[model samples]
Target: MTLAEDEALAAAPDTPDDALIRLLSHRSWQVRWNAAQNRGASDAVRLAALATGDKDLAAAVGQLGDALSSTVLEAVFEHPKRDGREQLGCIAHDRTTQERLASDPDLKVRASLAGNNEDVPEDLVRKLAADRRAEVRACVACRHALPEDLVITLASDRSALVRWWLIFTRNTREVAELLRDDPDEVVRDQARGVLGEPPD
Candidate 1:
């Protein structure tokens, strides 16, 4: 571990809040993460400043769940820094956070939100089914909580990979319809595997 990392580890909750805030500017990403994790609200505000100032720092701050608040999370989600958006989308846990991530212009950010099993709205999961990135679509297909209609729609996605994911994992009767007209042979095979019958 680097000196920054060591300093960060030292600035746990037991440490004075001021000391932890100062450590937010540490050169090491690990140290920043530690500071963000251990700091109080005031310190977290200070750390957010550092996080928003630099993409690397923002990424580190994103890893610090202990210091996170709905306010700070909103700021991170809206930060001009792209890297921060990726990390923020991964860790944010509230309705506001999910909304921001679902609407993010970056597909990776949206995908990260979809991958998070908690707090994702059903509407957002449906939107993710049409994401340009296959990874995002795959995440949507894997989300078992998605409404049955959304799952059925995703089961016919153009990407065979996404279609196969729904076909094999989803047991909804609605999914059986996709098998009847699946364009991808592999997806058709997977759909057949689920129903124990060949496609027409």
Candidate 2:
């Protein structure tokens, strides 16, 4: 690792807030990201300053993630800046932030929102299930917290991998009937295994 990388890793969570705040302006993006993550609430003011001034989008987003309250996130989410909204959405847990991400013009950002699973709303999960990207849809399929109806929809997806993943999840019964004639043999095998039937 480079000297900068070593310094970033050496900075601990308990390090003085101002020291961490100073590191946020380090030339290395990795150091700035690490410093932002370590700042927590103590460095919120410094983070808010960076969120508005940092030229690097990732660094700005990282600063927003470390903000003391949803206040900084809310500010960045509505900032006319436009460049960092997607990255901000990737970390912001507030419902309004999530709603904006769900409808973002960028599919990758929408996919990032879907991938979070924990704070993303069920309606958004359902919407992402129909996304053209298999990776995004797979995220929704493998989300254990998703409602049974959403799981059932994903279980019937054309992607065999998605169906197979759903077979191993808790709500297998919801899609048991749908998988009886799955086009992929491996998926059918998994469904049968989950249903306790002898494998073919």
Candidate 3:
């Protein structure tokens, strides 16, 4: 079938669920992609879309937001396919899904979860702050409104990058004295900015 015709079939509201499912495997990625994004697409179609591992199509499906069932969203988050899982971690709003992703083996996925998800549980926030990967810890350090205790812990973190973010994201005036002599020169300079001292 012609590209336009294929897309029309994929996107037609009247397209049967089974047919849409079949189109998900059509040779043209656009046809399959259109089928994936069809408003009429079913939970089954959404799950199939993630399994296809086409990053763009998976992203389009993610944009469907609340139109997507929790089961469908969970499937993508837990899918063996890694195509768009990191992006999913960044924007996931469902608490259960966010918790599941918090322990994902991929550091990028966990880091994304830490850097975004405004409603992330405080327990998870603490967990990410101490995460072995500096990148994950760095993300936690960069979040605002962190507890003062967490800020102190981050200020003492071994990774200069994590300490850098702590100073970068928080109002340094509150912790200026703590960070003023940090070993990382850039971090010290940032702390100085808060204290009105020159970067020596």
Candidate 4:
């Protein structure tokens, strides 16, 4: 093994199941991604790594193919830490958790839940599509699975920034075409540019 590989193994979680955790704090992105694809890694490690919210770390961990249990996932969402809001958002695709947090009295949690894409509850996302807060609704717009109709609606949102981001979603075709005549020159210009070809 190379010297860097040894250092990463040193950084790996030291639980009794450390071997199964497959922590991805490695020097190499490819190594981290490869580890996440390691079938031997346990669900606990995948969830824990995802909770850490590292860019490359999460890219690796979030792509893990292992099945997550409600017990492990619940612990991740309920962990009493300042980062709880961020962590819960990462895994909010969990139907039960997404639904529970959709109405969380805390606006931060509600907004946080808007960022997850996987396993997203359709109704919650639809509801958040028209959230009272522009920021929250913007988060829903950033979603990969946001409904096509919501994209069209948010294209006309009061927030220009929210309208600006709709250009990135696959659901943006109609919205982009519709925004071609928006009063905001930037939105109109971008929408016209996007109308040049179908969204990828």
TM-score of 1: 0.70
Which residue runs does candidate 4 get wrong by more than 4 Å? 1-82, 105-108, 170-173, 196-200
Count clashing pairs, candidate 1.
0
**Which candidate comes out best when scored by TM-score?**
3
> What TM-score should be assigned to candidate 2?
0.62
Q: Candidate 1, overall lDDT? A: 0.68
Q: Model 3: residues >4 Å from true position, as ranges?
A: 1-35, 62-67
Question: Candidate 4's error at 63, in angstroms?
Answer: 12
Error of 4 at 1 (Å): 18
Enumerate residue pairs that collide in model 4.
Answer: none
lDDT of 1 by residue, 1-200 (tens): 66954664645567666666666677766676666655543545444555547777666656554356656656666667766667766666667667777888888788777876456667777777878889899878877577767876786677888887776667555685666558887777666666677654
- Backbone Cα, N, C clashes tallied per candidate: 0, 0, 0, 0
TM-scores for all predictions: 0.70, 0.62, 0.78, 0.56
RMSD of each: 4.1, 5.5, 3.3, 6.6
Model 3, global lDDT: 0.82
Candidate 2 per-residue lDDT, tens place, 82-167, comes to 44565654566667667777777766667666765367777777878888877677766666587767776787787887777677
Higher-scoring candidate on TM-score, 2 or 3: 3
Candidate 4 lDDT (Cα, 0 to 1): 0.62
Candidate 2 regions off by >4 Å? Answer: 1-30, 38-60, 63-91, 171-174
Question: Which is the winner by lDDT between candidate 2 and candidate 3?
Answer: 3
lDDT of 4 by residue, 141-178 (tens): 77777666787788889987777777655434677777
Ranking by lDDT: 3, 1, 2, 4
